[model samples]
Target: MPLSAARTALGSATAVALLLALVTAWASGTARRLKSGVLPIPAITFPPGPAAATSSATDFQEPYFPFLEGEVATASVSVGDTSHGFVVNAAQVTQDARLGILPTQLARGLDYGTEALVAMLEHAAAQLYGATKTRLWLGNVGQRGGGDIDFSVSHNSGRDADIAFCYTNWKGEPVDPPSLVPLNGQGQAPKHGLRLDAGRTWIVVKALLVYPRAQVQYLFIAGGLKTQLLAHARDQGESPALIQRAAATLRTPVGSASHNDHMHLRIHCGERDVLGGCTHTGAVHPWSKLYEGAKRLRTASVAATLSHGEAEQRRRALQRLVLLGGSEHRRPMAACLDDPASGVRTAAARAIAVLGGRDDIKPLSARFENEREVEVKIAIIQAIGTLGGAGAGRFLAEAVGQPDREADRLLRALDTVTILRGPALLSVLPDTAAALSRAIRTARLLDAAAGAEPHALDRLGALLADRLLDSDPIDPSRLVQLAAIEAASDSRRLELVPALVGLLQDRDPTVRAQVGRALRMITNFSYGVSWASASPGTRTKGLQRWRAAWRRSRGAPRDAWLITGFKAGGYQVPRLGQKQTWELVRAIAGADHFSVNAQAVLVRLLDHRPPSAQWSKNEACQYWLRWIRARRQRYDLDKPPVETSNACYRPAP
Candidate 1:
């Protein structure tokens, strides 16, 4: 035979030999001995043959398969935050063509998930497609080891999976989507020539809810698609029980993608997995089997581990207790505050901060006095601050006056005052104001290059604003008064405008300048006098102009200045000068009094909003800054703002 023919004969013989081996294994019931459900398939042994020299016997082993019984042998574990978590013993979903589900990004290897999650997906897809010819497309679940995946914030764990929405043509014929198709409010994907198949999608959702292997936690879908699916289910006379479950599970996830093109499903951690470091957040639905008994068991197990386990284990246990969240765990957590391991003590302090109440202030303060480790002491202070009360405020007030206090501790104490706010800190303001004033003076005199106290001045400014602004007669020190004025601008203390105007004639030129700058920042009026460089006569006239402006504006609405040029149509920078426009932009980007309102006006001008409403104030500001930087020239102050796309801005590398 020719060489090519011989090669073809060898390949044919190898295939035949593998087929015979599988048949023989099945006949002998060796495959039957394997456990059921979605699991790693046991390696199959093949008889040595001519082809074995070229191909390893392992090549003939079957891929993981969903078997007869839906019980997982080794439960998969999902641990830590969903965005930064990892999974252990994750099961790879079967990729067989016959399963009626296709991996959207196979090369990325993001198809692994917990056995329960994999089984749920397989079962749900089978139930949907078994009655019809339509197919389901699966997106990312997690990587093989179940950590971070690309373009996702919450698929780090095996519990979350993304499955594409089922679609149909205008004629109602099933269409296998090549990828996820984004749909508009009317459930139509006009660009793709497809409409959402609400009925088929409901079937898959129902199966996921009814699946015995895992409890559905969330089914994230766009609001419009969710509405259509629920309406179709009700019209079809689906049981109210199932419909209600679907309604509760379907949501538009906050702080992440809206999931408009596909459904993002998350499953609750199993009871066994919970004991092994898996975590579940949000509400536990009534249908879930994880009840008080499971929680009690988990709590007890964590307590035991904290008592006997190593430092890392005890730290993890403390974290798990915080997640469990009950008053019962408080005693154990408080006890861990004295653990030999500083890491455990730090973890305990943080846990107490989240789960502790006002009563926890005593223990935390006591720990702070004796804790030698700087990190542990900082954590205790933070806990006491977070659990702000009269007692906490008093403790923090006294701590701030300590002559040898570290910069970080002082900063933290100041932050706690801000957190305490209103009555808690107000009742103790006299002592706090005096201590903070001294600290501010000391901080100023320190060498600038210490670098260990970065942002100390800024923090002190904010603290002075929060407490000293309400003082009947504000601090006498020039530095303290100056700090308060600067802070008022950033904090948008609308009520402080009169006091700021009073400070316009202060002896110190720098304090007078800051007050002028703050007034302009608050009310968006410069009054034609540059306070910093102005002569005595110009300063006097400018001060008069500010007083007149304040008198005329005092009776108006408190927020009138913030919306001075804002109309139903959009924001118009009042003067259209480059300086005015930049001032407005700075307010929008800075953590000032009207930053949020500024951001809203900017959003209106651009016809854009952040993708998720859950973005922090800082995140939103950073996003606007990036957007403005990219299109600075196009933003003509004289013209009406142009509309921009609603797409989210990706963070710059």
Candidate 2:
């Protein structure tokens, strides 16, 4: 079954069951807060510590938006057996009698993964003679909820697993208490009273490589241990091809702590997970076909499946055709653009976009006019954009000029513009200034309609920067410029800062105010001047101050560029233009590393409840601060505030 279909069915049934349960509880007068799509909450009953001190269901229910820029896990974990994959019990790994717990308090033991991979590794280890009969000790995979595991950075999802290296005593007997003995030059642990179980370790490594369900992307280990394992495999007469794969998959990861103690196995996102919105970073590979359900289907078979299979099968077939990419499949793939099912049509449109030519534009445009589904239309527009020619460019320009078009369609038009303006394509069609304005407006609409994507922000910045640099005297409207500035600010891209700095001296006061806001968003430095009240000389001084600050911290070795201390003569930010200014201030004040003074100011703003059409900003900030303070009081007070959700707070910096 397609996991997407199962998810929908299960989620619906669960929602109904939960509602019935709530109704029963209400009849008994036992229900308190009847939250939407969630069971009634009793007080959190987990043991009182950082491990158990997670955000409550009620807390997440409240409106607060968290800015998450890193390895983000969206939506809830799928409802099913966690062992098969969606495990919610953080205590499961900790309490498992089979696994030995490390003494490190940082290890919360909440890792989850496919049971198939686990079984394969265990069975492989058991096959080795004189191997330790003890259960494998495991490390963090992910929290039960599948967000960032506090102990490790990349274990946000369930695809990562860490297994302890097998170690033996001097007598060549497996030890009860596991130990990490560094391998010597001769692949033996000489110093400690332990030795590396090379034969047994090789078994586990080979199992990972051969697992049907799991495609190991990287088996991170120490350089010496990797060398030791490869040598052992070669010595054992392992096939050169298999040994090559082992070497390719096993290597030291960049910017990670040395993994001499345990092997960190990172798996690619399963095909099922991809259908459920799991995004895989980096390149796609042939192994992807295994999970995509196309490993056995050749081009003819896939093309046949695309024509006669179920909608899902057709979708998968289209995807496989894309991966199998060849000129022979283009005609069949293009036929899929008109597939009855939207999913199939979407896949077909995407494939066609990659393979189609100028000759295909007319049919795509005709489909665009007739298509009812928003996603399919977007896909068609993208296809048209990718197949850019004079005709395709004209079609996109015409769409852009449709003032009465739906916001979603306008957003697609903006996307089409971005593609058309790429390296291979000519200039943005119709007019550059109009295109820039459309992009800014379209971005704002998309943010409200579907939550802004990162690419939209990039397009907005690029268009505005181009106009600022070009000889075109047609400056964008005040609203357009402000929208561009805000989009750039939200993106947190420092490269956009250089382009925005020039706008600080623009004649429009709103532009100057927004420019200042964008700069402050990128770099927390505020040159002691006000956009609304500062004279030309004062603005220049402020600009100069910001330039100097940017230079000093331009290439600073940090995740984000933020000032630690306010310079001696730094400008104290005055009250600027309404909602945008406070939004910026609220973001800074609620940031993970915002100074104590800034936080205190945020408290004041929340308490005072500033006057604005968007009153939720004040309420949202207050709710966030209240949650943070309560959480801090219960747990570690010094830990920085993190984005729990995007409802009431800013995204990660």
On lDDT, the leading prediction is 1
- Candidate 1: which stretches are off by over 4 Å? 1-75, 78-94, 99-112, 126-135, 142-158, 165-175, 182-206, 217-261, 272-290, 304-306, 309-313, 389-615, 618-653
TM-score, model 1 to reference: 0.46
What lDDT tens digits, residue by residue, belong to model 1 across residues 131-156? 67566678777765444455575776
| Cα error of candidate 2 at position 525, Å | 23
lDDT of each: 0.55, 0.47
Give me the runs in candidate 2 sitting further than 4 Å from their true place.
1-110, 114-116, 128-130, 141-160, 168-219, 226-257, 266-302, 305-328, 336-359, 371-376, 386-389, 405-652
Worst 10 residues of 1 by lDDT: 37-46
Candidate 1: RMSD over Cα atoms? 21.6
Score candidate 2 by TM-score against the native: 0.41
Clash tally for model 1: 1
